[model samples]
Target: MTTIEAPSGRTTTPDVQHIDVLVVGAGISGIGAAYHLQHEQPGRSFLLLDALDERGGTWRTHRYPGARSDSDLFTFGYGFKPWRGPSIATADEILAYLDEVIEENDLAQYIRYRHRVTAASWSSEERRYTVEVTREDTGEHLRFTTDFLWMCQGYYDHDKPFQPNWQGMDEFRGQTIHPQQWPEDLDCTGKRVVVIGSGATAATLIPAIAESAKHVTMLQRSPTFFISRPKVAELAATLRALEIPDEWTHEIMRRASFAQGEELWRMSVETPDALREFLIESMRPLLPDGFDIDKHFNPTYRPWQQRLAAVPEGDLFTALREGKASVVTDTIERFTETGIRLTSGEELEADIVVTATGFDLSLFGNVAFTVDGEPVDFTQQVTYRGIMITGVPNMAYVFGYFRASWTLRADLVSQFVCRLLTKMDEQGTPVVVPQLRPEDADMPLLDWSDPENFNPGYVMRSQHRMFKRGDREPWTHHKEYTEERDILPTADLDDGLVYRR
Candidate 1:
């Protein structure tokens, strides 16, 4: 946020806001970045811009029934702030946590809500970015100039979810709903609900709606790994019984989760077959006797191929055992008047159909970028520590870890950005860009296109659009939080980057 005057020699007006550092999106990443900027670089002036009217990003936007944390809260929460509650938390609980962070950190004064960014133009002459945005309330256009642009809006398109082109979808008489657009007056009581796509959304919704819905059937083209977890925290309880503080308990639990996740990946590489069997057998008792574990629970891919969805209190399995819920692993042939017809020659009746499909993942929230009035294609660039694109200067985007808590990486990114700015201050440098080495051109490139590499459905669909990763750092992501933790914090900025005054 260290700055001089605008290089264009333009004077600031009432509608024009001049900032040293502007962090986009007021969600988890933006808030964390703001905190780091305030604490680490106290002299820098900054503000947060969110497209929505409020903050809390995903947690605030997704309010579907049974919407909660799929990952443990201890790690999901900010490193500075302790969750100090259940392993998995509801959306409201998380939103409240974020509110508390903002209130305690006094972030409210710096946040300018309802500023939907449309495009950004980087001016080499000015050494600044001219950001164009629209005020949602009045549709008024405003401009802002900033020394550094931090994209913390996340990597997904919030405008729409991915909906497959299914035949006869419009002909169905039953109500069709997408979890991303869940209605406030949605009536599922005593109704037959068919939740489609067995990802986190389906896993969360089926059990939640099963309590009141006459019957809930989870229909998926392919099965996903679902692991049931108890509501109580055994480790935490034991630790607190011995008089240890809740904060200490949270740290211990966090590290334990990290180690377990790393071990699971290791097992996947060494003994995938045995590990798969072990995981399937672990869930046998939860379901009714003689259940087909291979067909419904076991995914076609090897274990750790994708993230496992965590279910609370074994509610999903209990619902299945008590015959209140069922799962169907088949392709949707078409939609009938009263239900959906499967390709396996089966028709299931449903009063309401919820498409719990994945998101339309986009890089930098689909922000249009122009360097010196020329549009930049990020796909041709290499990422630096998965934070900054090679050709993009004085900009960093926050992309969290896939396996572990997202904030774990966000926390590191915040620290790195702060240090980067401080180093720039000391060196009298105003610009930093990743400069690919000469030999890097001969080095092989990697993409997240294949499921074997990084097989999340969301990424697979948009792999071609994302920036390429090299075989090694600061251009590649190892996908392991432990390795990233060891590398990113102390990673040298000049390794593949160029600094300019």
Candidate 2:
């Protein structure tokens, strides 16, 4: 193994280790990448590094009550792994599934936890990346050099959740909590709680805390669209009853879920009005009679404009109907001593306030990056098929779909990366970078995503910080899974990439 030299002008250390690939973030994407690397390129040396002490990234970090999968597990789970649990599974269940994948594949040996990557610098002359990492467990700094950089660190700032500063927030007497950093000792039993937000986090938290809290109120500036479905998939159950193989059942259910999601997406794009009516009408019966569905459940934007929060078994609606929880649709004027004062001059009393307001978007896990001693300003660059960035050599990141299951794209990107690695080995090329072709030099640069197509608050807030997208194939990033599923596997690797020895 080649020993990595310390940053230029520094003495080389014998302790520095070099590998063929270094996969960052031992979460869903990283774990999946490990599986593919081992299965596809068994001879390649690779390591999986995560900042956290555990494997599940989001699942491990989010400890709020009722933390669960918003998307069906059939699609969210790895394509290779057979998901036999309910379509909507709890965080514990998802983590358990991930554990199974690690154990079954013997991936634990490859993972090194508590290693947070601080900076990565690519050296074209050396044909490798020199990654600096801080060991959280010991506070010791270390380095690793790799021929390929596989970034699976997710897009959200796990350490800093986004909490809008309401007036008089500091003067409030009750404890304020953000779901991203839920206190383990926090107990809502008999406490009057007020949750602020209308997104999936608020929707999931309200129902989970309602039964224990004296009263829970979901305070939102506007409404969000929700879709309620059975927790268990009927077809999967039926197939199991018929004694079909687990692998076959998993594949069949996954395809069915994908088709259903495709139809919903198609309706949202082609017939939004009709789809909006269907979603609102479907939710009407689940809510209490005389409840202001328009004020509490309907959103001003079209369906799928942000995200359609899934309410498994209508649990959130059940809490609302049973009087365990309530929805208040109004803007907060400011924070009162006890709770919040609304623009309409109404005061809410609460013993605890939970801010489910979302989180800041983090690109490349907020790691500082440079190429050939020059800093990399991703915003000035463009993405190649949303996996590789233009001018960033030997690096690929997994930024999953917002409209569908994240793991679906994660699986696809992993497979593509493995294929690219195999081709590089065959060609004896040690470096590969994406470059804009002359024909596409005049292509109009656009936001990382089309706001009209998919504009979640997080993406909108951080769009300026992300890489740009162009108006053509091999430059665009936000393609639907149906299109990507067919396109990515056979995509021409040489279309926009430059390979070097």
Candidate 3:
């Protein structure tokens, strides 16, 4: 821990004391919260603690052979930090970028690495939170309290990988791997591979494994409806220009690109049938001539009902079209001697198997939260603009838009939260809570995650209840910035957010 002078010209320590804010998790969201909190409110004291020794939550944990961002770099990057590299950035590059941002902002002083927060209990009488954390390296437990608690801890538990129960999965002779916990020593040189799951992980894994594997078959219980488009060069270029010091140019292109994504999202939901057919047609050439598009591409649910895989460089489609990658729409009954046995009474042999099945959506580590020692379950809570979980006060969690670059939404959420905190101080409000009214509860939460909902990962599970049903634009996720601004701006804080004494 390093020390820095607060705005009041006093020495300050982020840890070992009651802070203005206690942010859990050192991932992008946590970093964003800490960065903005310090930059915008230097006088306010806050501490960022992570269970892991280092930052970069998901990006740090899941480092498979070909890990990279499928979303455009411009949109994927933090608003405060400009992504100067090519449109696509590798996992390592992203992790480096995160570290760079922390260093540039002098945020390391506030971060306590290897400190895992076990449980948090809110004190209504004190109007504060008491948190319990364990040091991973020292094996010592410590207790601390803060005026507010921010659950920046991402949705997945590091120990729990979403491994589905395949009947014969244990009997497989070939090695089995999950991308989340990919082993460093594992190699797939000239090996025949079978990747289970047709979601983002499978899409990314198939292409990378194709380069080294003799053959890689993407075995999906059903076909996933994916959409592809050219790299948003215009958007990227526009963001680059805005990253300059000039505020005018920055605001112009920022609003433009934001509105553009919003328009696209609107177009997607308004004309579902034509767009759905167009998407199906777009995929026809990549599949076998007589392949059943209806069975594979024609999902049972509506479009954007679950996440639509982004084929930025068409890597997955390129592999399929080049005969290097193939998709098998079959159910895996269990693990076979060398591969997977399908429910169709057939066997596909492989040297290794990768399960990209998906994730579990248990919010906050399936851990218990208590206010004044009374239990508080996030599932029993409502999300405020998908940020701060209701019934929790003076704290905020920043996540990305389901349809857009996560950072885009994260950036906005960070800004809004900082402004909210500032507003609270200005108004002498000690506590703020965004509680949804009964009428608002009648509104829908969209689930743009995996339709099948088999894997219980964080993002998918959150999406399952994050948005209103059928209200795709604002409720689910708005890829566009224009619409998001209207809903996320500081002026809209009065919608239902309550500021308590």
The best candidate by lDDT is 2
| Reference-based lDDT, residue 198, model 3 | 85
Please tell me which model should have the higher lDDT, number 2 or number 3: 2
Poorly placed runs, candidate 2 (over 4 Å): 1-14
In candidate 1, stretches whose alpha carbon ends up further than 4 angstroms from where it belongs are 1-14, 448-450
- Please tell me which model should have the higher TM-score, number 1 or number 2: 2
Candidate lDDT (C-alpha), each: 0.85, 0.92, 0.72
Per-residue CA lDDT of candidate 2, range 170-285, in tens?
Answer: 99999999999999999999999999998989889999999999999999988999999789989989999999998999999999998999999999999999999999999999
Off by over 4 Å in 3: 1-16, 229-260, 285-295, 435-481, 492-495
Backbone clash numbers for all candidates listed: 1, 0, 20
Worst 10 residues of 3 by lDDT: 467-476
Per-residue lDDT of candidate 1, residues 429-488 (tens digit): 998888888878787777744468458788788888988888866677636787878787
Residue lDDT tens for model 3, 1-501: 666555645444456568888988888788988888888888989999898868998888877877877666666777766666556667888888898998898988999999888887777788887787767886666678898777777766666777888887778888888888889988887889888888777887788879877889988886677766455456546656666543443344445556656665665668767767777888777666676778766776656656677665677887877778787887777787778888898889998998887666446644457876677755456556666666777767665666667777777887888888877888888888867665665665444443443222355445643423224222233334656766677456666678877
Instruction: Decide which is better by TM-score, 1 or 3.
Output: 1
**Residue-level lDDT for 360 in candidate 2:** 89
